[model samples]
Target: MTTRQDGERRRGRRPGGTDTKAALLAAAREVFIEQGYDGATVRAIARRAGVDAAMVNHWFGGKEALFAQAVLQLPFNPQELIANLLEGDPDSVGERIVRTFLTTWDAQDGGVFAALIRSVASHDQVANALRDFFIKNVFSQLASVVSVDGRAELRANLVASQMIGLGMVRYVAEFEPLARTDIDTLVKAIGPTLQRYLNGPID
Candidate 1:
């Protein structure tokens, strides 16, 4: 009953089932790079992946999450990560954020983040994709949640500046003691400032 196309599908990517996630991620990356964030549609990515559009929702929760995983190459879901970051003692959220950031990048030896930093320099789409993502998904949401001073937007940007700077120095620039500093030390040192950005004065 098996056909040549079936054999080929078995060797490479298939229409649905177990291959859906990988196929969708592959397709999402292509579509996001080619179409940009605003232009890339769920149907288009699903069509490219040769799967049902609902599969995108089923696997990734929706377009934004898909973009985060596919384009940003983030290891976890942004929304869920934010929600988890919001849990427990509110004051320590920034510490958790720093810890999580270091852990995620360190696990990959900063390879993924390093590549992203490099790609952002030369590729407009990559830069646009990154701007469309972390700024909105990670920064805005987390900052907004803890913001009591109505400065969520500014706070978000500040927090972002810190993380972006940290990534560049530690991963890309490979600068000094900061690069070799342990995650715990970085968290303890940077966390209070981040907490202030999210909850403290910015006048």
Candidate 2:
């Protein structure tokens, strides 16, 4: 009975105890930011978290997942995107979606997102992970709500390109005009294009 109880306890929480996953993620975020993606490593993150390297894999699947969770910290979970997309009127989905995304980016601490963009540029795995997160979590969820023809994959990629460019100029590069502009102003300018991608005819 004691042995069984011990097993249950181990399964109940990480070996490092409660909040281990959170600690690891936080450590990973800091390391990724300081080192950039290529410079950051699972062993380094684990060391910062004060846990074995194996713990990272145990908790997050691998370095890529850790990077996604740490750097992205997306506004909503992938599932939530689907739920929101389903809630609003289908016709205005594009506007709502664009506004939603802009709102999220606006709310974050600039440094966190800045690190993510830097990492994406330098590391292929990080770039792929970023792509997967958008497709599986954000775009796929949105696609489930508004049935568009042609593989949902294509539509998702189109939307991603628009958002990625917006991120680059507005957040990463801090380009003039876009960087200084208000969220509402930017949203108005870009929302229509995003809407078209989501719902408008593709020719």
lDDT of 1 at 118: 60
Local accuracy of candidate 1 as per-residue lDDT tens digits, 45-77: 877777778889999999877876886765556
Off by over 4 Å in 1: 1-13, 16-20, 23-68, 71-73
Q: What is each predicted model's overall lDDT from 0 to 1?
A: 0.77, 0.73
Question: What TM-score against the true fold does each predicted structure earn?
Answer: 0.69, 0.80
Best by TM-score: 2
Give the CA lDDT, 0 to 100, for residue 104 in model 1: 73
TM-score of 1: 0.69
* lDDT (tens digit, per residue) of candidate 2 on 1-203: 22545544543555665477887888898898888877888977876776668888888899888877777764446466557655867776666666776677778766766887777777787777777767667776777544467656776677778877888787778889877787778767877776677767666
Candidate 1: 10-residue stretch with minimal lDDT: 1-10
Q: Which stretches of candidate 2 lie over 4 Å from their true place?
A: 1-15, 73-76, 145-147
Q: Model 1 residue 202 lDDT?
A: 77
Please tell me which predicted candidate would have the highest lDDT against the true structure. Answer: 1
